[model samples]
Target: MTSGGRIEITGLTKRFGSFVAVDDLTFTVEPGRITGFLGPNGAGKTTTLRMLLGLVSPTSGSATIDGTAYQDLADPLGTVGAALEATNFHPGRSGRDHLRVLATAAGIPIARVDEMLEMTGIPAFARRRAGTYSLGMRQRLALAAALLGDPGVLILDEPANGLDPEGIHWLRGFLRHLSTDQHKTILVSSHLLQEVEQTVDDVVIIANGVLVKQGAMADMRGGGGAVVRTPDPARLSEALAGRGLTATPGSDGELVVGTEDLRLVGEAAHEAGLPVWQLSRKAADLEELFLELTSGTNRNLGPGPTEGVA
Candidate 1:
């Protein structure tokens, strides 16, 4: 595959006995950009990644790499590089040996192993046993293994699991380089919404085994909401109620104004003579937006999740 290979997941579904883990999921990840796979715990993010990698059999549907299943690809390692879990390496083997083993199995160049070690900043300690490494070191080793083939696409699940702030910053820049400079397709899964916001250009969110939203991050912020903080909570609540808006008390003395315009909310506070401590329009936070869509309660208040790719 070329550096601009694309990934397509079509109607993907997986079941274990009677329980359905993933259901009718469909989306595409384009090359030259990073796409974030986001969802809450038990939202089937791992299951979906496993299916895409052909590690697990899907009950129905399939995911493809450059129009073919991973097993059917001419050179799987050269086409798609993946790091699904942090502690997948053998404890007894040296970091360099671990990568060497995979490189041998994949028929990749042995020199690439050392290059990956150097690239991931683990070359100095490459001779040490992987079992002796710290969690952050293990994560770096895993990333090194993924880069061994210099593949056209990368599918990583929570790659920042054990990274420090500096490591996370390094990873963000590295992945961006993989996409922008190398023109590779990159799909990464994470529950860290803020991190994703900082790193990814596009996002695909799933919840309850369904697609919540998928689109460019810029379009997401266009759907706005307001955050209101008030001194007289009771009067503000009454004012909001009169205007057909709902208000739920949030942490501290702030209120999470659900489905209320900022100007109208300010107008209500002014008319009621309630002192407003804070009132401003908030650009939609993907994490908060995900909750509002899949949690069910937020839907009853107003027009819930944006129609298509919110």
Candidate 2:
């Protein structure tokens, strides 16, 4: 089997009239790893994916897979497998027949349809009509269709949407196997940061259609502020200030240090005769980081309570 290739997007912008859906987005997805394309709702993630797949043209810039645009690929399905929507299948077709139709269309062998059904763990339901399948089964069928051509790259949007915990766990391992064992390039998009945090090695975060941050998950999580607790909070605050570290009082009256260096804060407190009660480094979780990055963008407001009610 052929390994995955690099995906590069440079200055990619998309606009619908005066509304900018994607603005100057730039990133590179390397082979042999799963990269998460993440953002809040209305952040242009779907628009960007559509543009990449050549379903929607970008107003400016380029999105390329293996140094060529998706539209220009001689054998697009054989190079990139994508499942942007699980409901894109014909409801009347059986699960196996759905994949068979796609494989036949792609000039793939009919036998490969059963292979994909088994590969995606949906062979037992292969004879079931898609309309009768549950949402989770539909997702599996969509994935099977995407892998029908045995493509090197997999692009999935919210693939875990309807999966149970066990199914989600299975998917995580499955994606990891594709990237690590099969050497496939995988790009999966989801607004649920916690789900993607466990599956992706690197992340490209966007907000309001603009790139907010992009880097390894380890680096992003490690770059968070620490919390320090001392009996003499004021003295510790002063000590941190003396040592060129900023300390602010947390809501619970604990001193929140601005650095991840627990030892540095402890030493400064010891030297200042402030008894250290607790000094723990706080790593930022994906949810916290995501909320911080996209705080003011497209937040939903609940309707006001009924006027003069009760």
Candidate 3:
């Protein structure tokens, strides 16, 4: 299979009447890694994915896979696989029948149906009617259908929505395997920051339909802040300042050191004869950062005829 290429979005914008759904969004998803596309509800995540897949046209700018728009790709299905929802299957059709129908439509061999069922770990329920399948099973079936073409890139929107802890664990490992072992480009859109935090290599965060931050997970988690507790807060703060370190008072009367190097703080405190009671490095958590970024944005609760009903 051809290796996946870069996916680029440039100045992508979408508007509906007076409301702008997506506003001047731009980012690149490189191959061979899982990039989390994260934002709170009503942050235009679904709209952005829709544009990327050519289901919704952007008002301005463009989204392209391998330097070509999704619709313009020569072999779109073979090059990109997407699982935006698991509810698209026919209720009456068996899971196997559902895949077989799609396979036939895609000109894929019938043998690939079994391959995908096994690959998705849903072979045991392949003959069951899709309507009777659990949410997790439906998700697995949807994923199998997406992989029917053996696409180089995978775009999944909330793929873990209905999965249990075990299923979520399985999905994390499966996605990493696809990126590291198979070299497939994967973009997973999710509002669950904690889940995505553990799964993705990099992240693109947005809020209020605008870019908030995008970078490697390491970079975001780096620059650890140290929390220090001492009997004499003034003395410790002075010592840290003497060493060119800014020490601010934390909420609980602890000193917050601005640097990740705890050794430096400890040394400064020891030299000043201020006995340290407690010291711990504060590693940044993605969920914390996400909440900080999108704190006041309107949350998209659900689809309804009236807004803010529930």
Clash count for candidate 3 is 0
lDDT of 1 by residue, 154-259 (tens): 9998888888999999999999988999999999888667767889989998875678889998877755557788888878989988998888787777877776
Highest-TM-score candidate: 3
The alpha-carbon deviation from the true structure for residue 10 of candidate 2, after best TM-score superposition, in angstroms, is 1.4
In candidate 1, which residue ranges exceed 4 Å CA deviation? 225-282, 297-310
lDDT of 3 by residue, 137-194 (tens): 9999999998999899999989998999999999999999889988999999888789
Question: How does residue 27 of candidate 1 score in lDDT?
Answer: 96
**All candidates' TM-scores?**
0.77, 0.86, 0.88
lDDT of 2 by residue, 1-310 (tens): 7589899999998766656778898999999999999987677788888888999889999999999999999989888999988898788999988888888788999999988888889989999889999989899998988887778999998899999998899899999999999899999988879988888999999887888899998887886688888778998888899999999888897887889988889899889988877788778766887889877664223332222100
What lDDT score goes with residue 121 in model 2?
A: 94
* lDDT minimum window of 10 residues, candidate 2: 301-310
What local lDDT does model 1 show for residue 232?
85
Count steric clashes of candidate 2.
0
Winner on TM-score (1 vs 3): 3
Tell me the number of clashing residue pairs for each predicted model.
0, 0, 0
Better of 2 and 3 by TM-score: 3
